[model samples]
Target: MTFQDYFPIWDKLDPRQQNQITSRLVFRTVQKGAVLHSGSLDCTGLLLVKTGQLRAYILSDEGREITIYRLFDRDLCLFSAACILRSIQFEVTIEAEKETALWIIPVEAYQSVMAESAPVANYTSELMASRFSEVMWLMEQIMWKSLDKRLAAFLLEETAIEGTRQLKLTHETIANHLGSHREVMTRMLRYFQSEGMVKLSRGMVEILDAAKLEGLRDGL
Candidate 1:
């Protein structure tokens, strides 16, 4: 698919604006675990995912990391171009979670279009609002939800995202997603295993009873 397929406002942009983007758009493939953009200063440009997954996360002063959100196919990531969005002060790190094919719209190109096109500006604002909402939802989960519930929810979400009961994930990776310590996640998984909710082995977690897992996630 071309950039037009991934970008929703393509039809609204005039010929000149479209040309500006088309001229500067870059296509790249990144391997799993590649850091495409790091920190607020990187200003890596707008990321439009053609295929595969990317994770947007924040790190603590103590070096602990937590995922704010993940982008899948056809998703647009605005935070990657933090320099263009002057209101964003905090740092966000974007990494490829799977081998990804994507397009990078140069910040200058995007900014130029956004400056002249009302449709592009409105779409950008909507994207920014949506991302902030996700971050706020994550913050709520971390603040009020217990670790066990959060872990159960995360597992169910992973199953849905990967379309399998068997998840190829390490405990540490899961910990990073939920912003918990590995030892803590291990203990929680052990507890879940004891309850017959999951089966864990080296680098894998298989959900034995998703119904019970869902029940646990909902505090039943």
Candidate 2:
């Protein structure tokens, strides 16, 4: 798809603004494990995901990672352009969760357009608010929910996203996403296996009973 196809506010901008953005727009692809943007120091431009997945996360001082949100096809990522979004203080690392195709609008160009266009600025605000809401929900989960419920919810979410009962994930990887230790995740997975909610393999967990998993996730 072209820039116009992915950008919702394309028509709102006039010819000059459109030209400004298109001139600096860059199309690129990255491998699954590639780190697209690291920390709050690098202004990596505004990321428009044309295809595949991206994970946005933050790391603690102790090096534990917690996913804030994820971007998929047709998603716009504002946090990548941290220089333009000056209010964002925390560090966020964005990585390619799958081989991703993207259109990057250089921070300066996008910022210029945003300044000139009310629609673009409004869109940016809405997107930022949405991301912040997701982060708040994650914080609530971390603070109030128990680990078992959180893990069950994560597993169910993965199953829905991947559309498969078998998830090819290691304990370490799952722990990184949920901001926990691998050993704790392993113990939880073992408990789940004993309860017949899931069957664990070397690097995979297959859901044995979705109903039971849902019950656990919902505290039913």
Candidate 3:
């Protein structure tokens, strides 16, 4: 897909402004396991994911990595939007989950584009608002739901997103996303497996009965 396909704001720009902005766009390929940015690094412009997945995480006091968010293809990594606006340091580490392609624009370039077009600024603001709402919803889910309910909800959501009952997530990855211990997640998965709600295969989890999983959510 072209840049305009990923960023609809580009389509709203006039020819002159679009040409100027597109000319400055740079593409970078990140290998699997590469660190896009560390916690101590300075925050710059946003990193738009064109393909593959990325994880934003932080190191806890006990030296455990706690995942904050996951970015799939077409997601933008803006972990430190405030820092980027204020020209400060970032506090999150962004890592590539697979070989990824990203578009990197300098802060000045982003500012220039925003300044040139009111629609671009409005689009960005909407993006930030959506991200904020997602984070808030995730926080509420963690605080209000039990482990089983959370797992069930996650499975259902993933199924809808993947358009299939089979999911390609590991236990450790699920634990990170749920903000729980791996041992807890393993036990939860075992419970689901024994109840015939899910099946565990080689590094993958498949929902055997989505209706039963949905039933568990009502009990939450």
Please provide, for model 1 over 1-220, each residue's C-alpha lDDT reduced to its tens digit, 9 standing for 90 to 100. Answer: 6789889889999898999999999999999999999998999999999999999999988888999999999999999998997876869999999999999999999999999899999999899899999999999999999999999999999999999999999999999998878999999999999999999999999999999999988999
lDDT of each: 0.94, 0.94, 0.78
**Predicted candidate 3 versus true structure: per-residue lDDT over 1-220, tens digit per residue:** 8777776566688888777767888788989989877765555457888998788776667656666677887787666333554554436778888899988766666777788688978877787778668767777876887889988988998898678888998998788767778889999999999999999987799999999999998782
Clashing pairs in 3: none
- What residue pairs are clashing in model 1? none
Which lDDT tens digits does candidate 2 get at residues 1-220? 6889989889999999999999999999999989999978889999999999999999999999999999999999988988986766869999999999999999999989899899999999999999999999999999999999999999999999999999999999999999999999999999999999999999999999999989998999
Candidate 1 overall Cα lDDT vs. reference?
A: 0.94
TM for candidate 2 is 0.98
lDDT score of residue 103 within candidate 3: 81
Overall local distance difference test of candidate 3: 0.78
TM-score-wise, the better of 2 and 3 is: 2
Model 2 clash tally, residue pairs:
0
What TM-score would each prediction reach against the true structure?
Answer: 0.99, 0.98, 0.82
Stretches of candidate 3 exceeding 4 Å from the true structure:
58-60, 63-69, 80-82, 87-90
